[model samples]
Target: MSTQYTFEAIGTHWQIDIKDAITKEQSGELYEQIIKRIALFDAHYSRFRADSLVSTIARAPGSYQLPDDAEPMLSLYHKLYRMTDGRFTPLIGQALSDAGYDAHYSLKEKKLSPPPPWDEALIYNYPTLITQLPVLLDVGAAGKGYLIDIVGELLEHAGIRNYTVDAGGDMRHRTTAHMPLRVGLENPADTTQVIGIVDLQNQSLCGSAGNRRQWGNFHHILDPRSLTSPTHIAALWAVADTTLLADALSTCLFFVPPETLLKHYAFEYLILQSDFTVIMSPHFPARLFTVK
Candidate 1:
């Protein structure tokens, strides 16, 4: 029998099937490493997680010098700043916190209903590692994906030749079966109903649009370009070779118009629309999936 290792890692439980040569204790040790890595990533990078180092710095003023580990992600934050044309600004944390997501998912009493005002973002200096205003930063959009990347890298480095690391369903996967990973795409509107499934082998797959930021069918995939929610499209999933690409791309693609997205990203796609139609990228990995 193919041995299946099942447990929680990176905030999501997993079931990994391997050839019988891999022992249960070996799998258990691997899982232990995975959790340690998750804790490490959170301590260094997460903005929503209060116990993290970043949050500690954010809570402190008078210019706190960042540790060596935070320096790399600080570099990524800069890169993401440039790449997204300021749409993916880490300063959105202030906006998110103003909405009452402090310490947890719970928002402030007035946080839920209203929209943020335009042009309120603080000008952050990346190279200088300083902020001009009191910005409440939320890494909710990117931190989890970063965690997945780190875990996947660990699995790759440990000679776990074929493995998958999923952080709350955001996956960095590599599989061997002449096919991709058999993954179910959870509907943002109804978490139980998988809108579709995809195969992810030697690729990273992330679900961020449509069903994710939702109430009923309407959701929060707001386009920073237009500063409005996208219409008609029900869901969007992106597959790429890197977690950062998958994470950042998902935010924009889920929020903006299709034509606008085409101009922005050259990646492949599988977008589900309102009329029960599927619009896929020219080279989307449809060959990997079994439509059931």
Candidate 2:
């Protein structure tokens, strides 16, 4: 038996499923708690929200205190920023806006410039993040995944051992029965069809592609240095112990090679090229329809 809760939040859809049955009252309480937590995160991180902390930072350069749980996300950004040579950066928020992905979803193209280097843009030190310049910070790459992890933790703390917390398509799954959850990998070019399938167990899987959000030859994933999205890759996915890592790496793979990240992180990945060429780790637990 399973209980499912679905809602839209943080500019995306969220679905949480508990494999074990619980009282209606318990479900209601958990749903409330999850909603509140997601709201708190969006209030601080969403650049689309005019009243968000990100907008405040964009308005001025100064030291700002973030939520107590902001450290993990910030720290991950800092690390990936350095690893990708400034390609994968939170500083790309303004660049995204300049390319027409602004707060209004205008989708209008404009003159664009690359984001400033991380060191030149801001300094992240745990609970405090100091902005060297008034820059719009976007964490669309991994913020949702981190939140999924948080919600998963919330469920675990409630003594629920078998559940899945999925935001959009990125998700975290845990099952004590050891029964794997079979997930279909959506084909980027054709949403109606899946190119592959994976049996996700006590792990997280995240995927990224340019087709999801596009405007004037640009998608959500932008190269900080070139100020353009990579056209070579069609889609990519990563599986890891934590959704945060899986989510971040899925975006990172677009800018860097799997080997470049594999040296530092323990994860399995699959990259589908524009020409349908597949590059994947041997250990990736998935079967692709395109692979004969």
TM-score of every candidate relative to the true structure: 0.75, 0.98
Model 1, 1-292: lDDT tens per residue? 3445566743456554443355677777876887787677767666767777667756754344555454444555556555555666566555444444455655432323222322343333433345433445556666666667777777767666666666557778776655567888766557777766676788888776554434432344444445445676766778877776677667656544446545644567777776656777877765432356
The parts of candidate 2 lying over 4 Å away from their true place are none
Q: What lDDT does each candidate get?
A: 0.60, 0.91
lDDT tens string, model 2, 1-292?
6899999998889999999889999999999999999989999899999999989889989999988878888898888887888888888888899899998999998899888878887777868889988899999989999999999999999989999999989999999998998999999999999999999999999999989888888998888777888999999999999999999999999998888888888999999999988999999999889655
lDDT of 1: 0.60
Error of 2 at 185 (Å): 0.7
- What TM-score does prediction 1 earn? 0.75
